[model samples]
Target chain A: MAEKPKVGCARPTGGLVGQPEARQEQQTSQPTKEVRTMIQVGKPAPDFAAPAYHKGEFTSVKLSDHLGKWVVLCFYPGDFTFV
Target chain B: MSVDSVFVHKMWNDHELSKMVKGGVPFPMLSDGGGKVGTAYGVYDEGAGVENRGRFIIDPDGVIQAFEVLTPPVGRHVSETLRQIQAYQLVRKSKGTEATPSGWKPGKMTLKPGPELVGRVWEVWKTSMEAD
Candidate 1:
């Protein structure tokens, strides 16, 4: 019977730990920053009023206006994107 | 929400979304110009001048019960969002006494949250329960 490998005993030495090239890769991989706000579950959602296009008419929408109903705010990158 | 202007939103709804969904989305398509609202929601990408794909489920009390942010390459599902809203409504109707299990749907069995349920959830719930 083969001995089982010990957990947390295998550490890569020359592999992407502290290399300058690895650091550059980390910086380049930084995508959008999504941690700017303190939004959290069970907390009050940030309120905002903005211009909206609804049902062939231009109008304005306020977050506070939908207080007594369930609101689903769907945000996307752009309008025409296929995603 | 996005940094796109309201004109663009209207054009897109008229030209594209109308063909996809009937009546071109029954809800408001807000134009978060300059990513202001997106910034407040933390979904704004300053470099791209657009908001990332995000969704927030706000209850009647204005509390954010759930949220999700995804990269632009991924699309969100309306069915999943609807399911979550129903689940949240059930939980709220029960006043937090009932908790929905994983893959729970409307009219499915829910778990009663209490000290007695601790460590014995496995006995009460099974993965097979997810199938209708």
Candidate 2:
């Protein structure tokens, strides 16, 4: 009979610790950062305010203007990515 | 998790952004054109145009409750947004009677909170994650 693995022990199957691709895949799956200091949970989000296209012209936007509202600040590269 | 407004880094070109309005997708898109907002948000990739995919969910009271940023190459998980939104609502509304376990979802059991509930929380967290 095969020995049973203990609780919190390694999985009996794939994605083993020695697999370098699996490890590399894990890192690659996350957001890449040029700098080492990656922002994380509980950290204060950086603030931003820029020109906004309201109806026609570019109106300015300040982060503090909406002090009491939920802001989902998202930044994307250019105008048209498949993103 | 849940937010009222989304301020995308960079300001947009009026004509270009207006073009997107012709499409079906909803939600305002800001174009951090000058990189000012991108710099402030830490989403600026100087050599790159515009900004990196940085997302933050700031609450009504100006507290950043949750944030997510992705590199240009990776796709952001919208499902996680839904999960976090539901979890935040559940925890905030429940008055500390329960705590959201890992990989929590809507209609699932949240562990009873407090020091007495740590073991139970871990169990729930494990089960939910396994199911995830």
Clashes of each: 0, 8
Q: Provide chain B TM-scores across all predictions.
A: 0.93, 0.70
lDDT of 2 at B102: 69
lDDT of 2 by residue, B1-132 (tens): 111012221223243554665632234344444354455456667576446777877655556678767888787887888678677767667865767776668877777767776556555466536474
Displacement of residue B85 (Cα, Å) in model 1 is 0.6
Q: Once superposed on the true structure, which residue ranges of model 1 sit more than 4 Å away at CA?
A: A1-35
TM-score of chain A, model 1? 0.56
Q: What is the lDDT, from 0 to 100, of the residue A40 in candidate 1?
A: 89
- CA lDDT, every model vs. true structure: 0.76, 0.52
lDDT (Cα, tens digit) per residue for candidate 1, span B12-115 = 98998889988887877777765656766788887888888899999999999999999899888889999999999999999999999999998788999899
Clashing residue pairs, candidate 2? A68-B60, A70-B4, B9-B32, B10-B31, B10-B32, B11-B31, B11-B32, B11-B33
TM-score of 2: 0.61
